[model samples]
Target: MECAAVSAPVSSHPPPSQINTSPEGKKPPEHLRRIIGEPPGPIVALLTRGVWALLTALSPAARDALARFVGNLAYTLGIRRKVALDNLAQAMPEKSEAERRAIARGAYITMARVVVESLPAGDRMTPDWDKQGIEGEEAWAALKAHVATGKGVLLATAHFGNWELVGQMLIRFGVPLNALVRPLKGALNTRIAENRLGAGAGLIYPKGAIQEITDAVNRGESAFMLLDQALPAKAAVFVPFFGRLASTTPAMAVAAERTGAPVFVVMGVRPPGPGARFRLEVEGPIPAPKPGEFADPITEHTARVTAALERAIRRHPEQWLWLHRRWKVQPPAALVTAPSPGLTSGPAPESAPKV
Candidate 1:
């Protein structure tokens, strides 16, 4: 199968001592490494493929039932459950403990739906995408107009809802989307990449293709990136996310500041249904950074993006990909303080909601 051309693995080949390493820093024990650090064995890879195919074949009702079962199962298995629960608690302190737990487990269910049903390569974009796929009419009209301007679009979407499908649905609808993706290390993730590429979406490797991607956007080519994942300490700045400081990449903000391109936030949420349906949403644009907002343009812009994301997550509490360790990198105690004296902290000014 054809795969999107990604940059070479970010790091040079590791020494033998660090052969099987988790991206999370430390190495897991020998057996655990096989699950997290090392690539899956052939048998496991084969099983994964079989499952993917089987899931596609199942009826929508069956798939829905399985989605719930798998989501709860993952939580019960504690596959990053603690981190998810912690994030939910910290982000939504006002909610009851039981509500947080339900949201946490429901996130897994969303994951299961994503894994089983995302569109594959060569899936044609049809009128159905522009019709049933959209959730907000004005948001959709704004997005179409933004694309028409040939002024690059940089969409900062989280690992929320059916994010992979967001790209697929857009691609299928004849939108040119080149996503900044970090290809996974193992067999399962690699195959997943292959399917995404097949769906007619372009891939921009995150490690070294910033300039190329920026140029593409400037030329009217749209790009998407996940804004709710961890980044290296040296690269990301801590921004308030879900009430705590999360190390955020200033890429979207930086790009918007540099090119004067419009930044849009989007999501493909799975509405409650027993059919294959997704509400592809185009949220309002994040205003370009300005000098008066704060001492640093990057922080001001990124914090606005983070707040926008928080608002989206709040709208549908269970649709987010909660298992991700979004707040893994905390800010230094020195940097964790209230906003500077005169600068009020909040979301960037949204333009009048015009189509």
Candidate 2:
């Protein structure tokens, strides 16, 4: 179904899916707001805020260099450094170890920039998002047009580039967008979550949100969904990413198929320069499958969308977070290997333990 024709949005928030929204800043009367688990909440909060402040204090150019330097250093020493390198090797098999290492190093810096831009202070510093960043004008225009057409845009993006900045950029330009915010326990996590909301984005708790997301789209509002993470077998549909069967969520695909909502990809891509500035592009309205071509239309569509994400990441290998254990879940026996002629199919091998 095409989403290029609606004229109005149906709701400001999410689904009648009756989701539980986060309580970030408001101090309720109960001690329920205090640190739920361990890890010394006070220290973690202080360090996070302090780093945010320090990054803010530096000039844009200086901080940009520092972010990259720190990222590289962290990658060199990080427990997950090998993970990142391994991911890169698998994702870009043609690349040599040195090349993969370079990509991994750049990924750490990209992550640093992600962390910095996500900080509350970063929002304060970036008052002129339009002036500093370029491109994405057409993409944003497409999003506005799609949502205006009445089929609310089903936003699809990966954890590449400055993913968060895409929302911030839209908020800067007065476009309303909502995305799922993972619920983290503890008062500090709440505050950080609140800060994100305060910076001009809306949140939708993940549980029970199908109809809620549909309702939001029906209203001509846009909801952002990150589809590049590793999903559990229960929630996952194995899809080819970098030529491997990585478990991916089919929620967006199913939503589009079920509701006829238009799907769009909104990803943040930063150009090469001294400072971290993004070209937050929102592109798509991926056409629905014609049906009967694949065994499952949902898996086909999900894989198609994921392929688009892979293409985007390929363009800027350094910007994607390679440190993540994106391939932790192995393909099931049926998909991993076919039975040899006159022989039985073998079970899939186990993956290496995560670091």
The lowest-lDDT stretch of 10 consecutive residues in candidate 2 is: 1-10
Clashing pairs in 2: 5-149, 6-148, 6-149, 6-150, 9-219, 9-220, 10-219, 15-212, 263-285
Model 2 alpha-carbon drift over 4 Å, by segment: 1-52, 122-128, 131-141, 186-192, 338-355
TM-score of 1: 0.79
Cα displacement (Å) at residue 120, model 2: 2.9
Write model 2 residue lDDT over 1-355, tens digit each, in one string: 0000212221122222211222222222222122222333787778766765776677777767767777978987875998998788788999998998888888889887766555545343332345543334455566676644655567887778766666555444434556655556654455545554554445665576577677766655566778878878878888788877888888888888877876766666776676545665544555566866556778777876776677678777888878789989886898778411211112211210111
Q: Tell how far residue 22 is off in model 2, in angstroms.
A: 18
Clash statistics: count for each candidate: 3, 9
Off by over 4 Å in 1: 1-47, 119-136, 291-293, 338-355
- How does model 1 fare in lDDT? 0.63
Best lDDT goes to which candidate?
A: 1
Q: RMSD in angstroms, all models? A: 11.2, 9.7
Candidate 2 Cα deviation (angstroms), residue 89:
1.5
lDDT of 1 by residue, 103-141 (tens): 988888888776655522233222233345454555556
